[model samples]
Target: MDITFLGTGAGRPVSGRNVTSSALRLPAARGTFWLFDCGEGTQHQLMKTSHKLSRLERIFITHLHGDHTFGLPGLLSSRAFSGGTTPVTVYGPKGIKQLIEMSLSLTQTNLEYELHIEEIEEEGIIFEDEQFTVTAAELEHRVPCFGYRIVEKPVSGKLNAIKLQGLGVKPGPVYGRLKQGLDAELPDGRMVYANEVKGPSIPGRVITILGDTSPCENTVLLGVGADLLVHEATFAADLPDKAVEFGHSTTIHAAEAAVRAGAKKLVITHFSSRYRQEDLEQLADEARVLFPETLAATDLLTVPIPRIVEPRE
Candidate 1:
């Protein structure tokens, strides 16, 4: 899985960045991209990337703020003409359904595909499939905002070709079973256990995306042990009071939350418009003092999620 920051600026568009929208590309795992927060001009941003609008399978809105969800109607409408025949599901808080329906209703928009809107009222497991499970939790925000935790399911290990060859297992359908960690019996009545020819299973990745919020216990709880924690840093660390007043987080708050949660990597976005690209980089540097693996996200920035491989001595 990978993340592409379409717009990293907070509140509104600025010189260097647009509003808040990010795309989680899972082409190999789920055969589609999941859009997290579709801010104004998000469809326009997608036009600039190589991603196809038709491949958007789900949209997870963090809040009802215009900066996070104003572009929903336009994008949903545009997808109908962009060869998107598959059904798309949107997951968000209580007002999300009303927002989408009202926008589409007011504009008299007709969609070719079915749009499923899941308005979450409480925090728990929101989405689960064979490949991944998505959980939601309440965050400390101005409104009833939420954060999403995506946990990918563990995958089978690679087949040991040398070990298989050593056991005289020819390349055939039996290899498929062995690769799936199943025992195979040879024609000579010799049974070969899958463990003999299969490496260790690959652990899945965990990604947490938090919306606009102040420092809270739920933030740390939801973000705990994530492979990547995408937290909001809307202000410098020195302006904690102002950040709290605005119901946003500072660089220090975000970094502290990541550290408390024991996240492996932290990528800070939702930057205030007052700061330029260089200033944002400095904020990232400040966060790095607390959480060394911190990154400041900019528009169109893609972060590939690293796999947690076991160390072999």
Candidate 2:
């Protein structure tokens, strides 16, 4: 899994940064991509990356703010012309369906694929499949907003081929059965347990992406144990009061949440346009004071999800 930052600016678009949009590319899901937010000019941003509009399986809108969702209508309309035939599902706040429908109706845009929109009313597990589960939590923002936690299911361990060969077990369907955690009967009528030759299961990865929010307990809870915490740092460290008043967070607040949540790494975006590139680097440096594994995201920046491995004895 990898994340590509499309637009990392806050409130509006600027020269270097666009607005709040990011793409989570899941290589395990046949290279399909899931969009986190669709800010203005997001379609153009997607054009810069290797991602295809047809490969966008789902979209998760953080809020109804223009900076977060203004690009929805255009992206939806453009997808039809870009060979997007697969059905797409959108999950967002209560008014998201109305927002999309109004835009499509006003523009008289017809889509080639079936569009499914789901409005989230409260916080819980909103989506779940065999490989992944997405949970939503209400976040502290000026309007109704949410933070999403995507948890990938654990994967099975690999079969020990060398061990099987040492045991004189010829490679055949018996290896397949053992890999499925079933015991295999040998030619000598001895039963070989699967656990004896199987390594430990690999832990699943967790990613938490929050909307424009103030530092709150819910943010901490949503980001707990996440491999990457994508929080908004719209202000510098010195402006705590301004951050709180505007219902946004400073770099310090983002670090605080990372510390409380025990997140492995923090990647902050949605920066206010007032911050220049050097200033954003300074903000990231300051955040490192509290949480060392923090990165300030810029447009087109990609981060691969780190795998978890058990400690050697």
The CA lDDT at 35 in model 1 is 96
Per-candidate TM-scores read 0.95, 0.96
Collision pairs in model 1: none
Best by lDDT: 2
- Reference-based lDDT, each prediction: 0.93, 0.93
| CA RMSD per model (angstroms) | 1.5, 1.4
Q: Give the alpha carbon lDDT tens digit for every residue of 219-273 in model 2.
A: 9999999999999999999999999998999999999999999999999999998
Displacement of the residue 242 alpha carbon in candidate 2, Å: 1.3
Using TM-score as the measure, the top candidate is: 2
Candidate 2 has which clashing residue pairs, if any?
Answer: none
The lowest-lDDT stretch of 10 consecutive residues in candidate 2 is 24-33
